[model samples]
Target: MKSCYLTRPGLLCALGADTDTVAEALFAGQQQGLVLEQGWLAHDHNAAVRVGRVAATLPILPPAWQARASRNNRLLLAAVQQIMQEVERCKQRYPAHRIGVVLGTSTSGVDHAEWALEAHAAQGQLPEGFQFEQIDLGDPARFLADWLELTGPAYCISTACTSGSKALVSARNLVQSGMCDAVITGGVDTLCRLTLNGFTALESTTSELTNPLSLNRAGINIGEGAAVFILSAEPGAVQLLGAGESSDAYHISAPEPEGLGASAAMQAALRDAGLDETSIGYLNLHATATIKNDAMESKAVDRVFPHGVPVSGTKGMTGHALGAAGALEAAFCYLSLTDTQGRLPPHCWDGVADPALPALPLVQVGQQWRPGPRYAMSNSFAFGGNNLSLILGGGA
Candidate 1:
């Protein structure tokens, strides 16, 4: 398989609007990015739950693309703006048809639909600006293709939380199949009334900052953001070495109790990367902080890296961005792999650790890994047992 090089990544989440800002804040232990607020859902005005909402103003869309306007797309636009210069260079470097686009998203314009319904209920008519296609799972991809004016393959993945990570796999396939020379891939998700209320109904919404692998852990603090990457055949500081995907179909919302599915994904990733467990320099865990998820993931991590390796869950700093999480965490891995500072992102949680879970080597603040060709692994597991793991680094 061809090594997929992540030439550049653009990410915006609760932590900050760019990679450098987010990295500084993450290692600096600045947890003010996530805030507790109310009125996220229309009916639940008083629910002041902790959430990681991006505090940046998104770029406005052209009037021609107004119909496709939505917060999800806006967030994507913000991320794209960061890499526009590099992307334009790619446009000049590759064939127009050889550049593709693939994005992952769970909520796309549902927020607009929710408001349109409210306007309809109050005024008894659909709003003039609301377009049905804006709610499409693929609109983000379409918008990007048009914005970039490229004719390459474009699509979106919506496999719940695993959607983002799987997008990297899909983009890699496109390039490996000789369909494209380069692909812009990543994920974006916006907070909407539907998702907020649905999670609340499922009792997965947390009221405080989540404590992953902690006894007092409640549930996840839902967040919103976008992450975009310019992937190409040309090598860079960080390369996408391997990606493993599996669907265990364990449950609708709950992961398999024993973490067989999660373990399979991790093991597959290590095998795909042509590396053993000890080769990975750092691990970006998909620690959602939910009791069952933390427990299951712990077992899976313990099974895969028995000898131990540095691990950390960045969700505490950015909250859980859900569909965009995989890409966001992948960015964290990409940063660590290429970072000259050799700083590993610390586990951003309370010091209290849960004794029931396996004792993994979680990184502490200001910790640095050994020097070498850095390899970092990131994991993303979602509903319906959709699991994905990507290994990023210079190959051994």
Candidate 2:
């Protein structure tokens, strides 16, 4: 099968939109997560939790784009615009027909649905001029394709939190199958009361900032962001390397204990990359800070990388962006690979250590590391034990 390579990638997250800004913040050990302001959490008394929220509101898009008011759509549009601008710079290499767009989002436009319903309750009718397409699950992908004039296949992946990572897999397949010469794959998720209150109802909303793998760790704080990457068949680019996915079917909202399925996903990714576990120099763990999730992840990592490999979770900086988490973190990995010095920001393990969590070498300080790693892996496990892992590395 033909290989897929990542050419250009970008991110818009809580830390900052541009790559330099976000990278600087990460390397500086500057924390972006903060306690929710009282104004934003007017009614929720449990707003003390620190959230990784973008300091700036999404900018206004063209008038044509504004017709779609869904928060998810807005973020998707922003990411797509940024990605297209990059593509335009290298337009000769990736033409229109050769390009594709594949995105992931769990809540698509549900925020708009909630707003429509609320407006109807007060005005006795659905909000005027509200287009149903704006709230459709495929709207983000379709709108992006149209906006970029991309004629290749367009798709949307919605497998809960694994959505973004799954989209990358889909984009890789499309290129390997010769369906498109180049593809843009990533995820976008925006803040909404539905997710906030829903997690709160499940008692998964952490009271304090999340402490992944910490014995005192609480739950997870929901966050919003978007990330996108350009993939092609050309050489010299950061290769996708390989991807693995599995489903345990244990529960709708919990991972299987012992991480049976999560372990399989990691092992499969390594097998696809044709490398042993020891070859993986660093890992971006799916440390959401939730008890079950963190425990299961720790077990999986221990099973795979027992040599004290460097591992860290950026969720401490970006919170949990759900569907967008995988893609955003993947962007971080890509940056780590291509930056002047191959280095990644340390995972903020601020609180006391947790004895129950497995012992893995966690990168806890921001510093430059020389000699780029040959391989790196990213893990994304979602509800129902839907697990996905991707192994990426410097060009062969």
Candidate 1 clashing pairs, residues 3+ apart or interchain? none
Where is model 2 poorest over a 10-residue stretch in terms of lDDT? 33-42
lDDT of 1 by residue, 1-396 (tens): 777788658989998998788778877766687798888755668879788889998888889989978888989999999989999899999987899999999987788899899999999999998898889888899888988899999999998898899999999889888899999999999988788788878888787898888888888888888889988778777788888778899889999988899999998998998999899989999999999999999999999999998999999888888889999989888776666677888997877888998998889988987867688999999998988899998622
The estimated TM-scores of all candidates read 0.97, 0.93
Find the number of clashing residue pairs for candidate 1. Answer: 0
lDDT of 1 at 148: 86
How high a TM-score does candidate 1 get?
0.97
Clash count in backbone of candidate 2? 0
